[model samples]
Target: MSSGLIDTKPLAGIALASAGYACFSMQDALVKWMIATYEVPQILFMRSLVIVVISGVLMRVRHHPSILKSPYRGTVVLRAALMLIAWLLYYNAARSLGLAELTTLYFSAPIITVFLSILVLKEAVGAGRWIACIGGFAGVVIAANPSHSPHLIPAAMCLVAGFCWAWSTILIRLVSRSESTLTQMFATSLLFGLACAVSFPWIWRTPDAEGWMLMIGLGLIATLGQFLLYEGFRYAPASALAPVEYTGLIWAFAYGYAIWAEIPAWNVFLGALLIVASSMVLVLWERRSEISARNRAAA
Candidate 1:
């Protein structure tokens, strides 16, 4: 009974992580579907509004109203503003690039997160992980190939999105030290929604029936995706969740081909796989080292 219970924990974590990635993949597909018909600001506003409403209700019910309170109000506001920029840049990248390319570039988040944690959060990162980060970025270069004439705009947009995301990740880590993830998340949604709402007047056009459905789908899936991601983190260590996140690539490939008829090239796939594999190994290494250190201290 004890052995079975122990084995079950990791399995459950794996399932939760995979489910989270699936939800996120669906959200990306819905966003891509709407990009053709909806203005970026309109889509951002509606989707963020939906998330704020839903997450607010959840927080109220969970007796986690403190999630709305933050010790670092100014930092939280700046973080939310950065998130707004990140989302806008990311939406533009998705609009201009193929789904596969956008998704692949987004995976660079974990790598960026590590570097930011080391520099800003003062985490002790070793030399090996730094080498892995370098390799991961090299893979991004191979995948993006910005020097190529045709891929220039999308490539540049992806880089901007990545940089913005790196900043947001650093801000989130800082906020998480003093505030709940729920607080940070809800604040971000509220701020982003407001930004979107303000921009809507300038860019608003009435969405068609198809557009409405797509936007609704985008909001719903994104909300669910974020919920699952938070839940998975609650249940599992980050190392356990990292591998499952790669499943997003499979979903990206399927959705891109089925919906937009956009197929990734050989080099893109190779580079994406290299980055994912390296990141996963780095995560496993970190987790094992942590576990060993804990055991030694206990001993």
Candidate 2:
């Protein structure tokens, strides 16, 4: 809303989201693999520490002079909290659920966002949007294949993570209205790094050489992934760009098989496809609705 100038320069949000998802999906696989040999606390601590250092340098060069002098503290906190919860859930999922399942569940963020905006932001929710939301959740049911057990712990965590992410999106919208994207991102990165560093002392465990490299890779991937995610939203609205969230399932599936030799069952693939298709349909529907509204206003 800070209008120096306004021009729609196309920077494919979907593509950026896809790339970020791949990086994230790969990072999950790598981190889980490391967890088998190293403690979770150690991995988290190192990852947080390394990302902080890496992001600090990047921010210094990109937006030197002062980082925190801006008005982005709230956005930073929201983004960090959302990301922290999502990672915690996804990491937990990595321990039990297959990558594809976890990725599919994570895509539920956009659907959750749709509803959250309705309740919190008081955004208009038309019949079409409602249909899409229902369709998306149905697809999730298919993907999750939830039985009576309620033992689908990872899926539940992913859902909780999605809720946090939706709130974070709200925070981002509020923050971006007044703050620079770079500033918000830098602050969030710095906060997360510091939080992890502070917690590292309690859960410190020495890792082997391989573990070190893995942690470094995890940190680099996470940093780049987050930066790209912010860039994605900068380019496109979440409704217009949200469907790309599903592509991570493909990446997750590929990594699961290629790296871990784990293959998803038929039901998993089917459910995942349903979720992806439903989310995409919702995205397209939202775009059409916006276009129609613009045309009406013009007329």
Give the TM-score of each candidate. 0.77, 0.78
lDDT of each: 0.65, 0.64
TM-score of candidate 2 against the unseen true structure? 0.78
> Per-residue alpha-carbon lDDT of model 1 for 51-162, expressed as tens digits?
8888777667765645435567778778778777777888887656754466557667656666666667676666546655666666665655543243677767776676
Candidate 2, 58-130: lDDT as tens digits: 6567654354554656556767877777766767666776544665566678777777666665656666556
Name the lDDT value of residue 87 in candidate 1: 75
